[model samples]
Target: MISKQYRLDELAKQVQGEPVGQSDLKLKRLASLENASSDDIAFVNADKFLDLARSSKAGALIVTEQLRAQLQDVHQNFIVVANPYLAFAILTHTFERKHEQRGIESSAYIHPSAMISDSAYIGHFVCIGENCVVGDDTVILSHTKVDDGVEIGKQCFIDSHVTLTGECTLADRVRIHANTVIGGEGFGFAPYQGKWNRIAQLGSVRIGNDVRIGSNCSVDRGALDDTVIEDGVIIDNLVQIAHNVKVGANTAMAAKCGVAGSTVIGKNCVFAGAVGVVGHINIADNVTVTGMSMVTKSISEAGSYSSGTPMLETAQWKRAAIRFKQLADVPLTQFAKKLDHIQAQIESLESTFKLRK
Candidate 1:
């Protein structure tokens, strides 16, 4: 819960929403409708939760137009907006715990050649490499490694145990969660006399502004050109982006999705959990891939794509599998010959009937 309280009217102004009922009512914190109290604010975005919202004890509510109309007979304090969930998300920051950073810790190691801003916080046991640059108000948490020539921008948050390899750049407001390795070596090899020779990765990673990368993710460096993640891309935990892959703006990839090397994913694309895309393919803009789908080829148009069969009973599936296996054994030439014989017999019978008539 937040220590500070605000009137319903003040919150309405903050969210640019229309206020109804008692605008002077006080709200302390943000909560779900089912868990809200008299001092809390709750939001209603869908019809399934309307009953829960109606019975909630919240002093103030953020609601959509449909929900606002449904509660017109009731005298509950509410703020109506186009997107109640977005307003609720904005309000969450008011109750979130603020981390107060103390400038560079004594236990941190900083190279004399590195340029660090005065407003930046360098946590204990952190290592900053030579010629590396840390921007203003940026926080490098404990045990994080900043390799040589890495450039991190202002207002960025690098969580604990992150490894930023040499020459990689992060723009402002980029948030990287713990244990994520950026600019790691790409998986490239050349076959030489039945043995594989590793190709050295020479390029780095370039991440744009407002990108959020979740924990334990690995983004590989390119073999020649840099791997680029555009602005406003959100990647969930355990996602793997291969070398030289380009992810377009505002694309959101869920956990465990893997994109093979040199693939170009378009803008506003959504990849659900466990979706796998093959290498060197191009996916068009506004595409949404459902969970556990395998993309073996390029998607040229903007649409929702899915693959793989749905679940079925073992007995039913076995029967279907037998028929599928037998389909290859059918002979087209013999079947056509049998059909021709039946047609000849029918023609002979028709001629005899016509003569008798």
Candidate 2:
């Protein structure tokens, strides 16, 4: 990890922010408003944090024009940007600890048939099986297993304990966190005569460039074709992406999101925490599924979608649950039909009253 310090004006130029205080103030780190000290810089992205920003003892602050106006009375240094949150994000890379690539360890095992670039870093006890190719500047951390025929691209980071098997391929700049199982067997079985039979997973996983998958996620190998995770997709921890699933580019899935087999999710989609997408469905681009929603069918249009009921009081929820069960006996179609008939009767009564008058 590299330690860096930046001047207030220097950091402002990194994010195109306007520094309104002492430009020479040295900032060593970025911290939250509550935790920032005299040398650290903090950010105020929303109104909720304005109070804390006012009282923050930090050397400087990152703020939007609106927030800067609100904090004009406060005695604080300001680095005004168009979007404080975005500025904070850009500045994070400046202060974030980055791994330095070193040569492969002697304890690491690389088969004679494997081709590992000299620039690539293979950590202690890591294993690269036969016919594997690791590209330039790729870092495979300790205890990771790259099975036969697996190919990792340039500048990739495969964290500790990850399993890249079944001839998987990863593009450049991919980051797979610790304990993720890529190209593991898909959950495919046949219901034979009073018995279950396992089906061979003949396909692997193909990850695109700049994809980041979190720890403990299981991206199962396909039964026939490769499971595809497109470019710039970011998946959070504990998510399950089943066999033959194609996650589109720049799509984001939060923690515990599950997509069953053969589901094709569209690009620029957002699946909130715990969202469950069923099998064999296609979700359109720019779609957003809210938290805890269950997607059981295809979405042909781009829009925000949600399912299941929002939380209510226990008593209210119990009554609503009863009403939910009653829908089976009196479906919505029946209710619509009954309402149409009642509307016709009302019109007839109105006409008869006009004739009498």
Candidate 3:
């Protein structure tokens, strides 16, 4: 572990939380409330989880102002903050374990024509192909392959088992997690003589600075135009970006989200987990798509959009699904006939009153 320690007072100011008990106490690691021991620190953001804090074995707790008074007699040290969860995230770097430095392994292969900066580190079994450029202070971890004509910028970290295919370009400070395959051939097939003919992916992927791509994600290269990701875009694990997609700056997408071919995503958008956007659609700027939503059409409005059946009990969902299936069979004409019968009865009563008058 990194073993770096931070004073509780210093962290309290950063997170804007009130400090209860000893503010001078040093925290070495962060842990969940249920799993925290005497040496570890934990945070509680939700009031519903206050009961867990009362019985927690942790030495210190990070909490909001409202929750601090409730834990006054809990005997454990507490740090009251504005955003406990965000505070915990801010402090996560302090307790993060440092990686040990190792020299490049002997098994790694580097092409004679490849231009790797002297300051860059190449790990075990890494393969750098012909005419590739690895920039200064970049780290290519074990089993990574940088194909020919690829250009990786300064201070990027390419994790293990990543494949950067030919003609790909990553700008500065790009961090790619393990098993991510960039610049792969897009899913394109043409039918000829009742069989699928593969279309050659001749274009490339151009990613801007400070983009962080998660593990096991696949970003396909374009078919005729570049698949571009602008600066500060963050993508989660298992995402698939199809050919010729342009994702704008600072857009964040959660895990398992798929953007189809030729879709253009605007700046500062947020897509929840498992959201799927159809091909050739355009999403406006600052749009937020909720989890499991299927975007079959273009979103011209810059607002949050969501669609899907919510979670229900198995029996309840089954019953609802069955009712939904039978809805089309219900006759509107029958309902209109019943309404006409009621109207005739009301009119007859009115005529009987007029005759009495």
Candidate 4:
């Protein structure tokens, strides 16, 4: 938690922005427009929020070129960039909390066969199992468990209470948040006679570089092969990625999303919050599934997709539900014939009215 300070010109260069009006202003932190102080920097990405940004007491503001014109009267120092939000994102990393501790704690348990890097930080009560490989500058925080044969790469930040089991292989710069369970057994079972027999999860999880998995998530081990999470995949909290699933590069799954086993989701796809995908489906690249949808089959196109009816009033929804079920009772041919008859009768009445006119 070291204090960080940056000048306006330096941050602007990092974000590829043009610093205007007092380019030498010092910014101590990044904050929201409503909460920023004279030593902080705020950002406004949209015109609707420009009014709020204009009233902010921040020492500097990150604004897009489109918004910079209307903010001419604002007294704060300005950093004009192509995308204000992107500039803010770049600036946030410069001001974020840093991890400075670089040594193993006294209470940690390391197996004799484990090979831990000299520069890695093993926090309080952490356990490293047999033959585990911990790379350089990796931080295995307090109470985390690294099981046998686990291979963790350099500069990874594994938060407290997380479990890495089943000989999972994680690449560099991976950040798994607190309480997440990696390499857990998937929901695999075989129906035998009148009972369910448990199927063995014989595989592990292979995660690529720059992946960020949020807290409370379960990425299950495969039934036979590895569950692969490609590079730059970001998963939010409470999400479930089942066994043998291949999440392609740069894919993002928001909170509460679930992808069933054996699903091959292509690169750069986005699964919004509360979305559910069925097993054994192939989702094409660049597909965006909206919130609260259930993907039952394969998606072959690349576009934004949605399913499920919008919310309605309780009584209205009940009536719609009843009518929806009643459709199963009606024959399609009979309905079409009745509809055609009604259309013919309406056309005859319109012709008669036109003759009278």
Candidate 5:
């Protein structure tokens, strides 16, 4: 924890915010608007929380320039910025906790041919296989496995119980949370006479820089080609990425979402929680899928997509579900007749009005 205190003017310079009234007030930490004290700084990001901000007892506040006037009469110190939320994000690092671990543990097993940097930290029960390369300043936590021909880049944080299988590659600053399995065998099988034959997984997984994968997520190895996760992709917990799936740069997938085999998702796409994407499809860039939706076909444009109806009472839903199935029995010819009858009635009314005039 950070015990050092900073004046309002110094903090304003760090985030490029304009200091308003009383720049000499000292702040020790950052806190929420409702929980701030006289020594803490707080932020107001939205209009709905204006009342909370007004009532906060924080010595210093961070707010947008547009809302500065609203707080001006309150006689409290503040820093005005173009974006208060972004400024708050920058301030979080000042109070962030650092878990500093150094040196290789005595219980770790390293192969003679494996290369590790002097600056990296290897924890207890770690297994480094032949031809593995651990980069500088990387931290591999306890009970992790780094198999043969694997290369992990600099400044990565691999949590406990992670398995990086043979020949897999991870670029710089990639974070893998606890219990993640990378380069696991894909779901592949061949049909034989009255039996199922297994196909060997020949390819590995390649992850680009700055990717963060959450806990218990499984990224499978490809059957013939590599399964690629591009730069800055963020995956939530319990997600599944199957064989030969190519995810473009900066895409985000929420928790419990699964992408089937050979699906190519474009850049800047967003998949909400529990969204399921089918196999062998291409999704366009900048697409957004709502929560619990099923994507069965390809999206050719950049837009938001959703499926599944809203929830209703159980008894009401049961009746609506019955009517939904009965829709197939409705006659199509009756709709055509109704349209013709309406058109004739309109034409007769028009002719009668003209004769009266």
Candidate 6:
């Protein structure tokens, strides 16, 4: 068990919380309200969780000022803050998994022609190919492979089993999680004599600074131009980014999302999980795509977009789907006939009025 403690006063300043508990009390770890013990710390985002806060076994609770007033009677220690979740995240990081430092292992293979900076740390069984430039303070973990001519910048952490293919360039402070592959060949083919011929992918991937790519993600290299990921981009696990795509700065994509080739995504856009974007489409800046959406066209405006069948009971969804499919075949002639009959009745009434006149 990890038993690291933090001073309440120091944590309050870091998380912008007002401490009501002992300032010197050491907080070892954070936990949920239901699961926390007297030695653990927990947080409340709103008053809806006040009951849990009151009944919690935690030594202290972090809560917003609004919620703190409602919990004045609770005997548990407290810290008041503006955003409890953000504060909890800050505190959680204190006990979160620290990045392991695996110094250069004897079994690792560094090519004679590779220029690795003295400050970089290469882990066990890692391979660095010819003419590769690994910058200062970079850590390439175990079983990873850096192909020839690749350039990785300063303070980058390339996690275990990651493969950086040839000629890929990563900017400073990039963090690539385990088993992610960058700069692989794009899926390009041509038909020749009833057989598919592979097209040589000539372009590389250029990733900007402060990019965080999650585990098991695959980013393909371009066929003609570079696949560009701009600064401060956060990509979730298992995402697939195809060739020649240009993702703008500060954009985020959730897990299992896939963007086809040549698609240009604008800045500050958010894509939820399993959102599939077709090839050659342009998504505007500040766009937010809902989960499970299939984007097939260009979006010129900055707004939220969604498309998909909503969750429904199986029987109800089937009935609705059947009716929707038959809507296009509904007869317009029937409506036209009904309108004609109504018009004839109006004419008859007008004739009777004329006869009276």
lDDT: worst 10-residue window of model 1 = 93-102
TM-score of every candidate relative to the true structure: 0.88, 0.93, 0.81, 0.93, 0.90, 0.88
State the lDDT of candidate 3 residue by residue for 237-261, as single tens digits: 9999999999999999999999999
Clashing pairs in 5: none
Residue-by-residue lDDT tens digits, candidate 2, 262-315: 999999999999999999999999999999999999999999999999999999
lDDT of each: 0.92, 0.94, 0.90, 0.94, 0.93, 0.91
Worst 10 residues of 5 by lDDT: 93-102
Give per-residue CA lDDT, model 5, range 214-296, as digits (tens). Answer: 99999999999999999999999999999999999999999999999999999999999999999999999999999999999
C-alpha lDDT (0 to 100) for residue 281 of candidate 5 = 100
Q: Which regions in candidate 5 have their CA more than 4 angstroms from the true location?
A: 328-357
Residue 93 displacement in candidate 2 (angstroms): 1.5
Residue 167, model 5: lDDT of 84
lDDT of 1 by residue, 260-288 (tens): 99999999999999999999999999999
Sorted by TM-score (best first), the order is 2, 4, 5, 1, 6, 3
In model 1, pairs of residues that clash are none
Candidate 6 accuracy as lDDT: 0.91
Number of backbone clashes in candidate 5: 0
Give the count of colliding residue pairs in each prediction.
Answer: 0, 0, 3, 0, 0, 0
lDDT of 4: 0.94
User: In lDDT terms, how accurate is model 1?
Assistant: 0.92
What would you estimate as the lDDT of candidate 2?
0.94
Q: All predictions: root-mean-square deviation over Cα? A: 4.1, 2.0, 4.1, 2.5, 2.7, 3.8
